[model samples]
Target chain A: MSDTGLNPDMVSSGGASAAPPLSRIQGVDKVFSNGTVALKNLNLDIGRHEFLSLLGPSGCGKSTALRLLAGLGEPSRGEIRWEGGAPATGSATDKGHRDIGFVFQEPTLMPWATVFGNVYLPLKLSGVSKAESVIPVGEALEMVGLTGFEKAYPRELSGGMKMRVSIARALVTRPKLLLMDEPFAALDEITRFKLNNDLLELWRQQNWTVVFVTHSVFESVYLSNRIVVMAARPGRVYEELEVDAPYPRGEDFRTSADYASHCRRASDALHGAINA
Target chain B: MTMSRPDDDEFIPLPGLTPAQKRERIARLVLPGLILGFAVLAWEIGVTVNEVPHYILPAPSLIAETLIKDWGTLYGSLLVTLQITFSALIVATLGGAGLAILFTQSKWVEISFFPFAVILQVTPVIAIAPLILIYVDTVQVALLICAWIVAFFPILSNTTLGLNSADHNLRNLFELYGATRWQTLLHLRLPAAMPYFLGGLKIAGGLSLIGAIVAEFAAGSAGSGSGLAYRILESGYRLNIPRMFAALFMISITGILIFMSFSLLNHVLLRRWHESAIKREN
Candidate 1:
């Protein structure tokens, strides 16, 4: 299902009516108690099944924006709408079992659980019996190419395998929106490249709305349909770049002229934001 | 890069060939046994040469003879001491784990109660044994309580620290998964605490033995039903030095047994995945 030789907006055309926006943020602002303004009057629309990346420098509050959307933290001001309506008002803690999934920068696999047990956790929390959870857990493991590692403990797995388990855990719940916070930041370059390809494949198959947070310009350009660049020290949107690269873009695309130009543009934008 | 063959993972190497391999491997036994045998030989020789009084450092042979001759009385007292130690150990495990869970749940409870736990740990069991005897009615129960007090804190402190020491990232993952507080405690926190709890248990195992013996000393209960502590005292008073040595030997053996049992348990639970369990060849 590669969107080869296609405009960025082409992916949004046919499903525009059927798959409504999964999230809408309108003029959201976040200020900390220490007199630090983290986000300033940000407005964005996240469409269903679109892999949107928030790219910026280290303290640009990309993580904060993701946190706000995940309902882990409240926006200091303005509205966040989910599924065409304003997000329910209250503390994020009050959201009582939301169906959102999050993968952190670190693998964050539970040390005490086996690979299978970690993937099965959300279902177990939802009161699914062990017998019923087996099929879904196996399928998730299979998706991540960790079929035989079910009984292996987290400590027994390599760093990449651990992250794969973490990904499997997030995917097992079948969430509509998947939020990732620099999940591959700790992996080696080669592993990160492979995982990025696998992630895009999973995105194509599952069609979940994704909001990825990253500090790397190249990663954002390669993976996102649109990149929302933010500036640091009272973060606000500096610019939004739509990546016109076709879907299922492979290693060869990384060597192409288009990829280099996109990376250069993103890099210059980031540099300008930082210098300013 | 090619991965190592899966069969290589299952390989267990033997050091050498022939009975000598078995002898060399089991030769660890020889050193300790030789030392013990030499010590016994020296004792018997000293008794013969110096014509030392039987009331003082009796020969190992004499001690063994006394142990065998008085097997009924010594056996009965051994049973009593074992009962007290095991009972106290059970109480400590339950009470320590329960208090640890409580401390993990409430910050205020931890702050208020943790110092008291420290105080209990540092205070000498000998100093409190008399007071505990005064308050508690039965000798057995008083001894058990004192032993529990001495043994309980390490497990409590270690397990509580372990529970709080869970990986911060993992805790966040649990929160993202919408796990309830109790579910997190049962599934994540408690299992993380196991190794620490086992560490504490190893320490507590020896302490329980010491506590039982010390409590018995403070209680000053003697005669047929008294524990091994009384046997040591009785033999000492009667100048049956060999029997006293035998009682001391039994106590040391009990301590080693406790250590071995806990080490075995630690191996059985964590050996499959933990580094501590994997034996390295040097």
Candidate 2:
């Protein structure tokens, strides 16, 4: 019932207009039709402008929680309501007016489409014409270091480059919420680290509420200002550890004693989570 | 900003090719042509030396002579055969791809009609041609129907497989973006199926030609308006073996040309992205 890591000052420090309670996920129970209880009695509030990571072992239902928030799958039982009673627009968009950006585990770019076309997909779905979408897509591509590769097919890209294109596509729409599921787990360590820094840069600049799911403690500590360690066997929230490491964490921070202590704390929490 | 065409990791270029690479490339083409020329020369000489009768096995020279002598008649017949072949292929492609899309749209439609498509595929075109000949008023229409039946199944099955093979994650992403059914079908499934449908089209090209010829053979129509198939039958009945060889040559060349054109189309469409189409160095 108690949140373990709370940095009272950090949320409002970065000029992040991200107010807390971006959404309240209360008592969510997700049971698949074949009867796998992926999540049980989960309650959490996603903070605004926060880079939050759901850290857990495999099968901890971190992805399941992300999926529910993406409006992809409904929980078998529970309620998820936005902080401001949904956006002010009554435009009657197809997806119940919840604007979200989602990144999957795979790069998942359209192989047949060029990078420009792939990034243009979300805008296109919202009925924006190709000519009209050029600026947004281009800006998004530039943000992810994929500006020159707009015409390159997915096959032309290395794994890291493809993932960059994917991230660009997600950010193109400028959604208020971004949900990512283990996006860099497949990349080599160096690429993952580089991407981590770039992603943090983007998060800082954009101030979008991020709910990232990952199995790495080091990653959660490095990127996230808040971490939710979840447990398996009917996956549920185990602890909320606030990574009080100040903003602009860089390579210097990576080798610092503070980073080591944070890693140690997350690892201990994870160890307890797996055992429990 | 300077950019190059996307580099292929699999491709490794050898430093600089001297005369050897040129020679190898030329040999690949010239060797086959030389062998074919040698074979034809041998056959011509063998026939002249052995004094073989024209009906028994006409020399290559005689076939060439007959082809030149009957140029106007043979050319018109070739055109007729080609017209039927192309018409049947177009019909098959449009019908098969359209039905495959409908099948993807509905499980009940696919389940109900798929076995019937299988039945149409397995039953011989020759066996069906006679019945079609009776039922269809025009001989051309009957032959067209026969050709289409044989060519239809490959495109249907291949496109269906392709439509189903869209990346699971990509489909999920599309769903996440709230792409409507029509949007998903148009943007995802159909494009994914393009390579498969093109592959099926290559196979259907050859089959369509064979179907046209076979159906025409089954019909056995002769004289002024007859196709190359009728020319073959007429030559056989009249014991004009040289003319028969000429007509047979035309059919063989036509089939090869059809296959090559489709292969070219597949290469053009897919070489940029598809793994099967892209050239690998390793």
Candidate 3:
């Protein structure tokens, strides 16, 4: 993907809101040292408690945008403002971690640690003693349906179970903002669907603002309230589509005409992005 | 629905070995033993049939006899060699790993001193033993320095690689979680480097033993307080081939024991996670 047409109006395109966003990406550009413009003039506003999906094909800077939101790296030109100006840095930098929990494309677990230990990591880093962390860690594991496997190592668990552990680890910190970069992309469909249901349940219950990045049209439509279709070559937003579906979306929703229409809309937008 | 969990209880000290794995483990021991038994038997028969002189080519039986007969003198030499080998290995472990940690903490330090470490490792310990002995007043200290140089590099290089090779994603996670530098080193880097450090320890164990013997030979320190190497040298000069073989046997046994212990340590430390230690069904 190469940078070509610069859409001036695309800057903060769909970010107009009454209440302040959980985080705002304004005129952000990420140009790597190798001179590949991963993102150019990208804009998005992650609202509180909204399941927003950054949908795009590969090289569309979807992950880059998510990382930028996480404060993983500085945007080449613009700025990402978390709620209340810049993030406060004490012990936890409030960057990619502190008030934010990030799940990468891979499970990214510490193989040597047990499931409990892996989940306990964020708490542990924040200076919570193991004794103090037991409740939160257990709750996280319980949420991910991995309570019984706390003693298990990553290698001993199946791929799906390992990913559950990763999810549990992300949830243990109980961050208001959860940034997932195609967390279920590597999973089989059955497991992915199960995790999607579980994740949606957790998001609804906890009221977390989740910015999920994925290319799967069906997954984006099924799990997200808002899907931002992004085009490649200096990744920029192409379209913002909303799924006005209610809570507790399950197998019925997955098979419904509503879900199909949403998927169709997202699929067409993605095709447009790929061809553009 | 619950996750598809493994049926076997994971915390079992020894996971129930599959029949194939059991058979493989048995063969690992029995096969080597069988071959060694036949070889020893052949040697015994060949010596008797040829009527070879004991001084030139002692039979296995004669070597065993010599080992038992010279137990007092040989045992003392064995202790001396053991002392030096273990001392060198312990010192090398601490020094090498400490230096590796230091090197990893600062790129400038590594760049400045890594070449010197390489020089010490590549140059033969035997070639430098005479100079060490001449410069150092204490023969034991000189031998230790020589053996230490021989055994130090593996731990240094392997640990450096291990510390640096911690999973990048995990490093990012640690940074994300605001893990302190000490916490990262202790929790992430140390555990990740364990298998590598154990691997280096195994190699250094054998190398230290070899270094001790080679350095002793170069020193040519005989009489009382001498190691097994001097005993072998003394036996050779006196044409006591059986005694020489007996000392050689002890050295071989010690080396095997060192390797086996380190292997056991590696297995115990990494059985739960590392691919090298885990027993796969496929």
- Sort by DockQ, top down from the best: 3, 2, 1
The top-ranked prediction according to DockQ is: 3
Q: What is the DockQ of each candidate?
A: 0.20, 0.29, 0.39
What's the best-to-worst order under lDDT?
3, 2, 1
Q: lDDT of each model, Cα atoms only?
A: 0.79, 0.84, 0.84
lDDT of 1 by residue, B41-143 (tens): 9889989899888787777778899889988988888889989998999999999989999999999999999899899889998999888888877889999
Models 1 onward score TM values of: 0.86, 0.90, 0.94
Q: Write model 2 residue lDDT over A1-276, tens digit each, in one string.
A: 134433211222221334567788878899999999999888877877888899999998999999888877788998887876753221335422336888989999888898898999877766778988888888888888766677788887788888888888888777889899999999888888888888887888887889999999999999998888889988988877778778888999999999999899889989988988
Candidate 1 stretches greater than 4 Å from native: A1-20, A27-41, A84-98, B1-51, B221-225, B278-282
Q: Clashes in model 2: which pairs?
A: A5-A242
Candidate 2 chain B: worst 10 consecutive residues by lDDT? B1-10
What would the TM-score be for candidate 2 when compared with the true structure?
0.90
What's the true lDDT of residue A203 in model 1? 84
Model 1 lDDT tens row, A149-245: 8888877776777788888888777777889999999988877887887888788778778899999888998898877777888777676677878
lDDT by residue (tens digit), candidate 3, A1-276: 111223423543233345778787888899999999999888777877889999998999999898777667778998887787654332844322457788988999998999898998888777778988888888888887777777878887777777888888887776888889999899888778878888898888888889999989999999988888899897988878878788889999999999998888788888888988
Off by over 4 Å in 2: A1-20, A86-98, B1-28, B221-225
Contacts from the true interface found in each model, as a fraction, amount to 0.15, 0.24, 0.30
